[model samples]
Target: MSAAFAHGLIVGKFYPPHAGHHHLIDTAAARCARVSVVVTASTAESIPLALRAAWLREAHPQAEVTIAPVVDDVEIDYADPEIWSAHVTVFRHALALAHGGAPEIDAVFSSEEYGPELAHRFGAAHVGVDPDRGRFPVSGTMVRRDPASCWRWLSPAVRGHLARRVAVVGAESSGTTTLARDLAAHYAARGGPWAATRWVPEYGRTYCEEKLALARRRAKATGLPKPWLDDLEWESPEFATIAERQLLWEDAAARTGSPLLVCDTDALSTSLWHERYLGVASAVHPRARHDLWIHTSVEDVPFEQDGWRDGEAVRHRMDARFREELALRGLPHLVVSGPPHARLERAVEAVDALITQGWAFAAPL
Candidate 1:
């Protein structure tokens, strides 16, 4: 460990501690004697600053992560004139107040807009993190703007707090269709709420159709060249869109209080497809950091051609790609492999484990 500094502050809107955010904090903690995480209550309902503080507390019990109060009284409308003055002013005051107090920090870690400004203003060193060579996805604004379903990028500790949950993940053609349906049935049979993977019904094809439709619609609405717009739409069949969509689902799941919900695949699993399709470097979705990850590998079963069929080589590469990515990220996941029945059995077991874990969490209440 490096020489421990007197104190360090990591300020953020955490929204929730996504894996990337946690990684950054964990990195910061090692370099400092104490880490005080000051979370901004950015909006009226921006995932409770207190809950973020609690999450940091739970995730890094070892680090001295303190939650600073909302000194900046502001809302989400950046366009408003009152926000510009009130926003930066309140935040600067908060930093001054924090730095002025006893046990002052020597440094602050951040990946925010005013990181450098804070460091200079407070007379402290600033730290920056770049997961993909300066391609820092440090925009809490982007995350906040993402539909509620996008909380899938959040850490598992946060996701576990949700009531309705669903995960639909499996290897190529391991009967994910039947399996998702069966899981919903089983949950209902047990007198529980139902969840299903109805997003794409069968991934890719529906998305392709929708993209085509959107392209045409936009062309008509804007009176732009139909071919050009259609081409733009064609290139936009990205993994991020689907990943973002699933995130919206997570929002719904968390809010419904449903016992169980079925999902297709999450960002972690979806990263494989993204990597293959978009050529983007794959990182585990924040949710996978602690959320249970299920790896499907029931090969030797018949593959389906639901309009998104590629050669086995492509599927195999994508599958292994995700598994390798998961391992590299050091996420908590289970690789369910075997025959169809065996695979489904493993899935049930994995889900049961999550359910038990959920129930165990509720036990404290």
Candidate 2:
């Protein structure tokens, strides 16, 4: 089967990349042999041009389309020829770079009134998909105003970037894992988008176990006694590795999960651990941004020795350090004390309030 056009071009701001944008691209892909989806964004926009293009690429992996990103800061004014020229220059540059030269465009697919003009400029036919927005009644403006309302219209990749991230951090054996799991379960029970809610477990603990196991193996080879967890040495760079891996896990989950992500511990906690062991501030800076933090108190929680704990004293010191750092950094957080059930209740309330407050996006130009 042959396509109607040899090469088709579709251009848009794709502020957030919603279902409507995907529909238009799909429509063009079906009619053209090859499609070039050009994403444009200004410095004033909240979402980056590259990120928008990446999302489109992720959404249409099966389609024969190329995603190109361009940064156009010129104000959008149909009446101003100067502004039009500036935008067209940016678009042409992106197309040229994507094709390695000025490839001939057979058709220009768009949903705006300027489609004909854009096609004429490129000596191509004007192919309008859905000008009335009837097939997919959504726009970038609608998505930016209230993302939750148009949640279904967005792909998992975009949802991951927009989801409300809640980090649960505290001392060892403080029920951080339990709280994170329960929080994810709580939302998953609601079904719908919440059904895919995910929880990121602590990666440092796994790293510790692996390190201790390696030490034990080395001990056995030397005919020495089996090494305990306390025999393991801590290095400044180890904490940075833990922090980096923790964020990677969180990002993977966010891209596959629901609109809410629960984290057992984050990179910030890794810094505190580094200080506790090395007696110095760590170079491991947090790379991911969390929307909210929940501190689990060790008030009534028993320090269960899982064959790899630093004792009750260390737990108390680390708990206090978490409290101090969270306040010192001016991060949005809440401390939940008491029993496991009670702590979960308070965390749920805080998370509910966060969702109710909704996401705030800067107005796009």
lDDT score, candidate 2: 0.89
User: What are the models' TM-scores?
Assistant: 0.47, 0.91
Model 1, which residues run further than 4 Å from truth? 1-160, 164-166, 192-206, 214-238, 282-290, 358-365
* Residue 320 miss distance in model 1 (angstroms): 1.3
Off by over 4 Å in 2: 60-64, 79-86, 130-137
Residues 243-320, candidate 1: write the lDDT tens digits: 666666566544442345565566666666556555775454544312555667646665665554555677677677
Q: lDDT per model, in order?
A: 0.59, 0.89
Best by TM-score: 2
Candidate 1 clashes between residue pairs 3 or more apart in a chain or in different chains: 149-247, 149-248, 150-247, 150-248, 168-263, 168-264, 171-296, 195-262
